[model samples]
Target: MSKPAKRKVILGMMAASLALTIGLNPQQADAAVDINASASILVDADSGKILFADNIDDQLPIASMTKMMSEYLILEAIDQGKISWDDEVSISDPVRTLSLQTELSNVPLRQDYSYTVKNLYQSMAIYSANASTIALAEHVAGSEADFVQMMNDKAGELGLESYNFVNSSGLNNSDLAGSHPEGTDANAENELSAKSVAQLAFHLINDYPEVLDTASIPELEFQAGEDETIQMQNWNWMIPGVNAGHEYEGADGLKTGFTSAAGNSFTGTALRDDMRLITVVMGAETRDDRFDETEKLLDYGFDNFHEAELLPEGYKPDGEDVIPVTGGKEKEVSISTSSALRSVIKNDEEELYVPEVSLASELLNEDGEFVAPLEEGQEVGQVQLTYEGEEDVEYLYDNQSSSTPLVADQAVEKASWFTMSMRGIGSFFSGIWTSVSDTVTGWF
Candidate 1:
């Protein structure tokens, strides 16, 4: 062929390859459902998949929902052995003063009164009690100042950039003019986006499931001393209503909060069968608006979205025949998946494209002898697939990766007599005599 003809042929092949690559990528689908909240989000708690989001990244005041961080930090303390449910907490003058003067939600703690950490946690989770929150923060960090720092640190670790913390309690501290007046610092505004709050709630429920148990209780009464026991009802109404029904049965406990500045806000979770979902709503006009919006979001999620397994469990890439070395009994080796393979899929009409499995070249040497001591299920290579028909795909069409052994597999026999003899002699010199006897006596 002429040089000009050859160049044209090469260009055509390159263009064909590029087109094929583009054809296989996965494309994002449009939002199939609409929600009523100003800012709302629904996510699969297990896969971190965003099933639906509306202005989810917009930052908004979370009101007493800030207690979620308080809950997480406290649980982390319990996990780290810093505090326990049985630990006793005493209400200091600061706690008492905050409890008495603040019109904010509180557990009505009295001066010098002691309560268990468990009760304090219940107060914060169920009632969004600012006083109990401050007390718990002080107990965990020795001071509210330190606790706020810890909260900010955790937010950073969780990649929450829209959030900032000024106090253990979520009270707007800036308006007080009295001697012990509350004030909000510029940093204390403690803003977070709906998506970020949803992320935080997911982590809390997924990691510490006990939180739902405490938060879901509709009513509880406790006392500080000779004073009458106060009845505390869960502010999140969904727990007693729709969530209590079989349709919303997986509904777990979460928090609700409202302030003039923060408006109505809620973070809720529900698990239906194997599917777990987290919904966050913020910036509602009325106290009940947050819960209503959250319910709508969760309803849309459970009604429309479903957990679908894309790949069969235990599906794996097959390994090519590997050559055995020297005197090994087996001449070739192969590998397979040690466990099931699977992926979460949407219930929508869009189907998950089948994955393509690819393996590396067969293991062999220049002499054509098989490599001995081949490990079973060793990741010889990868498998990948591209969607058959898709446009404007963001991610690659095919997923390709290496395989790994579910369990450890090693060679029990040596490949060559020379290699086995060397190992035997080394073992004998090292005071391991059995292997040496076997190797030497085997020659006979």
Candidate 2:
């Protein structure tokens, strides 16, 4: 058979296996087109599952969207109690120097000017103020160089495998801008993929939900203590949908960026009841195109897909049993899969099948007891789930199949046998020895 024919045959066999395992009614699966800028992605924020992706892994300059990491680390500092929103940050000479450069955005900050940390965050998130970013970085890390290090460190912690940062402000090249004449060294560009940006956006909203309040404000004017008030407008056009004269309900706050090299880029988020989705569009031809593409992607995600709760609450897998442990306080301990177990269901005519659960092997024990010092939520054994279509055959002679393993949630604990046996043996040996010695020496 030809390659296409062979693929179809294999798919059929795999579908059959899936149907038997998950008890799913056989249904057809359809593919969807990914629409966006050069590289785009839409994903379920809570699950980190990719709903749609176009050139997701390709790394590119993210432009002002790089501020997201800056904002994240700053907020994280606040959350850790290291910095407070009300804390006053003095504008240092370095910050003053950067603000003086006209090529970059600034709030006309002066040396010795003091602004609340909260206001700086507002400036960064609301207006994408480059000066505010530098001030906050300097305040937080003592220098922009140290703050960029923190940004890279946070990216690593987030598992952003294809991301890097060289500056808190997403300056393309300092040499080209000639912003810092004395410090005219060309700064390396910050990089991130569309998928990773989506993930980072999700982390911001999901983990530190309070940031949304600042980012979502439609407009705010910044006053620097008797200095001229600067009118700040939100960069995220989706908020209230005023950019294109179209209203998008449930549109929340996010960031947008543009640079000669990075092109027009955006990371937008929307919510429809319980289902929250994030969309990232990078490297668009024009500013308007980026907004239009992002709006379209958001619409597609909201209209075509929905959150399907696959496993009901408190639903445990079948055939789940107690796993034995050695050298612990208990002989065997029980574990159950705790995942909510859900998937994104497409709004198509074909019936969607359920995923089947499987186990890798039974639990094992060394000698009479299990391994010691088992912590809660530890995986003692493996379980897998296979997703497939339902088979048509009704009788036993029909073809059946298996699928790739989905890991089972396993919990481990101390085994009681080891604990009890050791205690008993120690007591018995001590008692006998003590009695014999006492009898021989008559020193009870």
Best by lDDT: 2
What TM-score does candidate 1 reach? 0.71
After superposing candidate 2 on the true structure, give the runs of residues whose Cα lies further than 4 Å from its correct spot: 1-36, 100-103, 175-187, 241-246, 319-339, 348-363, 366-385, 389-444
- For residues 246-330, could you state the per-residue lDDT of candidate 2 as single tens digits? 3468878688888878899989888886888888999999877787787777777777778765554334556554545555555
Evaluate model 2: give its TM-score. Answer: 0.71
Model 1, span 1-444: residue lDDT tens: 999999999999999887776555322123334455678777777756676666877788787888999999999999999999999987867677666653677767876566899988887887777888888988999877788889889988876747767676677655222212134354345678887887788778878888888887878886756665767777777776433432246666687777677778778888886888888877777756666666667776777667654444345333432333444545444444454444334446336455554444464456654345455546544434344444422211022221222311334243567766776788678765776788889999
The worst-scoring run of ten residues by lDDT in candidate 1 lies at 393-402
User: What TM-score, computed on C-alpha atoms, does each candidate reach?
Assistant: 0.71, 0.71
lDDT of 1 at 163: 77
Global lDDT scores for all candidate models: 0.67, 0.70
